[model samples]
Target: MEVEIISEESIKPSSPTPHHLRTYNLSLLDYLVGYPYVPIVFYYPNHNDNDNNIFQALQRSLVLKKSLSETLTQFYPLAGTLKGDSIECNDVGANYVLVLVHGRLDGFLHKPDLGLINRFLPLEPSFDQSSVGSRVTNVKVNIFKCGGIAVGLCVSHKILDGAALYTFLKGWANMASKSEEVTYPKIISPLVFPAESLRLRDIFQVSYQTVLKEAALKVAASRNGVQQPTRVEVVSALLWKCTIAASKEAYGIQKTTWLNHSLNLRKKLPTKTSKDLIGNMMRVSSAVCKDNDETTLHSLVNKVHDSIVKVNDEFVNEAQGDEWYVAMHKLLQQMGEIGSVGPTEYYIFTSWCKMGFNDIDFGWGKPSWVSGLIGKGFKGFFNLVTLMDTKCGEGVEAWVTLDEEELKILQCNPELLAYASVDPSPLSNDHVI
Candidate 1:
């Protein structure tokens, strides 16, 4: 799978950002996440008439580039540079690269090499504070030989999260397709959760992946006398269980493990304008298993559920009040104590499920597949798992990255294998969008 860089340019906003909106303040959550970026690619199969495929591809490329320019005007922050804890909205523009893949989309999707997929992204997802250059977003357009296209984006976590990324993409698609519906990005996250001065520590975040089929998910969800577990809940519990086992095997003893699930704060927050509020409006819910505790699926499920429940309306409201810094301090303090007691591991879980990544249709059709990377070739993250919806929209795909030894043991786990298909092809779903 060779990719030729056809062209490179910066896609600036179609219009200039007003002088009043020049400096976009970073929320406390945004500052806390440090300098990572979201790396995702959306694969769209070529559906134009074969006779006009060549011409169609050219025209489609024009539409995408043009629409992206217009979309950036609305998402002005994306076209700016990251300055300290804020975004210098000088309309610097996002780095847009046009690449031509020397292979067909199907060929790549057939095997879908995780390592090779990073080639489609313009920048690596992991970065330290000093490494976070001015650019807030990077876009790469990969045109396959078959006239198919894969749009990959690496947006700074300092400005966007999974939900915000979806909003940005949908807006771009709406412009490209010339759809009647319009997307208005409400940059109210900063106002809602203002940035604060607090001591921050870097927490490593990264991933490796596995796919859990619908049938297996069903069994896993209900296997433990637990009545109705959500897909995310069951999958998180299962993976946590596997990680615990792998750790015990590797270390010859049980180690207390902690699971931190990222919870979207949009709905939980009491803000009336949160529906369209963008940025990293998310927080992690902590669930732990002591070495002596029962680590059954049922127990894990309950723990996962309970941990998530703690991040409800009340908790969010409290965090947003005058004691916000105090709340943050306590949260970080708890995280700092991860391995203090003894041998322990902490895994971070974030779900892109139900975020409508598959439904982002630029014009031709919804993407046949959507993919992302945790932190490839980057050491800032480990023991991270990101869950996304499969193309069929029925199964969950879990991308996890763990230690090499632990990963080897996890790959051979019979229980996990029974439920997950390991690294399967994206076309296995056989459905687009």
Candidate 2:
């Protein structure tokens, strides 16, 4: 598990960005969310023989850096430094770290040490004013003792979301092989989601983790034929249910609780945005569940679904209006009053299922695993759980970051455990390409 820093390199864009494309403005969604860095790791098994392993690793490293530089030409903003509310896309460059790992990749994969996995990451994300500075992205390539490699990338969430990152990863990999097939990501915020309207900030917390197994979710879905909860709905409801179960000790069934989740506004837009459209295009939708309410898993799912559905065409259109900002300004004053993370509050669930993250391939093979860490060292305290695609099949993995006690309560929850298991192996299938 010892990850030693062998060297570090700064990979500048292969082409100097045109002056006209230098300044990339922060979209409304970006300004509102203002999230930190999102850390993603990709593992590649070394295929070279022993003596040639070192030489091959160096060669692969060169390919990665060169391809990354070329990729930056299209994703120019990533290589630039961040200034106030915008990226100076002047081709500053991104951090690329080369590390030597003392352990084999299989050990960590077999008994997956989440902490050890993080050890491969390059930069530690921070929250200070200079944290999300220029050099919006970072790369770490860990060469395992067995010659396998793990490529860890940390991207500024303020710049893009998981979908954008996936497309970026593909472009970088394609360039590594010097392939010409590429799709330039479009910055359509100005046209679709204007920047002036994005004046909200990232507010909210608690620590917790829980998962909803695909089978159990299907069962839950079938029970209520009228309510077919997607994987995200099923998992969100399950997390709310368990949080309620765990909260019984502190607060009885008398208080009101909220389930705060994000809705992707891309599909909700009147004219569908191109899949290549990048930036944070999400809206937070809150569903209330008081103790007097049904409070059942089905009930929770119904509530969440309804709240999100309400954020439809009208709500999306309002995002471009001045009144929306006024409402947000008022909501900002009442943020603390709305709720705080105490024994009673809300859980924020962000789903990344079907984001195409599992499809990133750099010629070695598809990643053995993938995770989205907001680059925070320790887990936070809004019962935050991130659900992602298993990629092996239709199942999804709900990654919750809770303290030991609360997590144990969720882990031991008979109902949840029956459906969603924790940390299923990424290699447990015949589809690992």
TM-score for all predictions?
0.94, 0.89
Estimate, for each residue in 200-240, the C-alpha lDDT of model 2 and write its tens digit: 66643322223345655756754663256677777777777
lDDT tens digits, residue span 147-247, model 1: 88888888888889889998999899999999999999899788777765764645746556677755555465576556787889988998999889998
Model 2 gets an lDDT of 0.70
Show where candidate 2 strays beyond 4 Å. 47-51, 129-132, 178-180, 204-211, 221-226, 250-255, 270-273, 326-343, 374-382, 429-433
Clashes of each: 8, 13
Best candidate, lDDT: 1
Residue pair clashes in candidate 1: 205-381, 207-400, 207-401, 208-399, 208-400, 208-401, 209-399, 209-400
